[model samples]
Structure formats: structure tokens, C-alpha cells
Target: MIYTEENIEAFNEQARLKFPENKKFFDRLKNKKIKKLDEAFHPVHEEVFDEVDCLKCGNCCKTTSPIFTDIDIDRIAKHLRIRPAQLVKEHLHLDSDHDYVLNVTPCTFLGSDNYCSIYDVRPKACREYPHTDRKNIAGILPLTLENTKVCPAVFEIVEQLKKAGLGNKGGIVE
Candidate 1:
């Protein structure tokens, strides 16, 4: 992956949040690729990983809106002390693809520093922002791929994978 040491470590730390099924994809890769990924999966080198912080790179928060489930709407609305419909009317739009998404660019809920204004009640998608670590990799591989440019971590990880000979998995771009 192309991630700097810092973001790669952050992605490793958060990898557990991904769906377990996402792991199955590894089974089909060349062992060299798997070994490299395994190495990458190891706990981040403290200094290398810690040096890069999301505060410095809020690309993900600034560029994309997480898909909001109904439960997410209810939770975020209750947290904001507004009706879900009202929240939707004021801030969200039902995406034509059948998902709920924020209506504005940079996200209306994103703070200036790219912190989520609704951190505690951010949507499930936000909570699981990079689906790369997902268990359902088969289903979400496309989503993860789509999110690459918007997430430096995913970008780095895929770049690393390509270097490890997993380019067949679509980890590298032309």
C-alpha cells in the first residue's frame, strides 16, 4: 500500500473493525502477497505509525459521506435531539442508489478540522469507514476500491499490496 507508515499503522489498528468475511480474499492470492500482507497486518511500528495522525489527514471525512442506515438516523437524531425526518430534511438526502447520505460536500456534520461533529453518533458507515478490513470483502471490495483515493490509508495499503504481488487483486492502479 502507498500509505505512509503512520496511516498504515492506523489502518492496522482499525483492521479488526472490518468484517471477517473480507478475509477470504486473501486465500486466493499468491503466498508472497499473503506474507507481505501478514507483515503489514502486524501491529504498527509504534514510532512509524504514530507519527502519522488522522488530524493531519482528514481526507476521508472531508471527501465522503457514510451510508446511513435507519438505525443510524434514529441514533444521530436522538443525539441531536431532533426527529429523524427533520434531520433528514435539513441535512441528508436519500441517494438514488437506495442509501441515505449527507447532502452537502465536506459533509454538513464535518467540523473545520475534519472532525465529525457527531462523532459519538456518526453513522455506521463512518464508524466502519474503510470497509477494506470488512469480513464481507466479497461484497464490499468494490466499495473499498471506490474509497481508495478518498482514504490515504486504503491507498497506501493497496499500493503496498501491489508491491507485494497482489496487483491481481486490484490493489494497484495503472
Candidate 2:
């Protein structure tokens, strides 16, 4: 499916409907000690991303904030020619987790065209928004499950995995 707003909304609805089944599948995946979990996820992640362009859908940036690490703050501040403290004061707030996140939704740096104003110096979490391609795939199944709601690509990836029998009771097929 395309990543436009209407399509994203439809995808969100479909994801919501499928979440319970997906959760069960993810639970099974987590319980298994699959040594090749990353191998399974990495290829599917590449394939799904090949078909879905995030620039066409900024739902994650519009709906969620990435934790801004000190390094991210420093780099972005340097790029913007501002003090780190100044950047934080102008755009960030400490969350319950005590991590710095953007104060506003749609992100202070996200443009109308869904481009990040600080694309080169964006937060590390922004760089890895869906976190699907990272290693230790089993460890992050819960995060991936949650991402399915926010990212159409993630929803598609999970659906593809289901089709591949990755989380079946019979165990991963390949």
C-alpha cells in the first residue's frame, strides 16, 4: 500500500485489527531461541523498505518523538550553531523516562514535505525509527509489534513474516 495519509490511516486500522493475532505470533517468536532471528528479519526488512518510502509518510515523526541522546543534542546543536542547552530549551523537554524528547508533535524539525530539517544531524532514534533491521530481532519483537501501528512498512514486514511461517508453532521454516 502507498504511504500517503489516507493509506496510512487505512493501514493503521488494519494493523489495529490484526494486532491481537500479531501479538500472539510475536509471543511465540520471543519464547523461541531462534539463533537466526536476525537473518530472518533483515532480509524481510530490506524487502519491505524497498517497497515503502518513509519520505511519503511521516506518521512516526508526526505522532511520536525520538529520545534525544546527549550525542544527538551535541551534534544537532553544532549543526545549528547553537548551544546544546539552547537547543534543548527551545525544542525539548525531559520525559518520564528522563530522556530528552521533542516538546511538540509533527516534530519541530519536520517539514511540510515530510523531510527533516536536521536530516543530517537528526537524533539516533530518528535514524532507526522502526528498529526492524537492527540485530537481536527476538529481543525487540515487542517494539516491532508496537511499530506496526505507526509504520506501514513494519506492518507489512510482520505480515510477510507471518506468511513465511516465522512465528508458527512449528517454528521458523527457514
Specify the highest-TM-score model's number: 2
RMSD of each: 8.9, 1.4
In model 2, what are the clashing residue pairs, if there are any? none
Candidate 2: Cα lDDT at 11: 77
**TM-score for all predictions?**
0.67, 0.94
Candidate 1, position 65, lDDT: 78
Q: How does each model score on lDDT?
A: 0.61, 0.87
Which residue runs of candidate 2 sit more than 4 Å off their true CA positions?
A: 171-174
Give me the runs in candidate 1 sitting further than 4 Å from their true place: 1-51, 167-174
**lDDT of each residue in 100-126, candidate 2, tens digit only:** 999999899999999999999999998
Worst 10 residues of 1 by lDDT: 40-49
TM-score of 1: 0.67
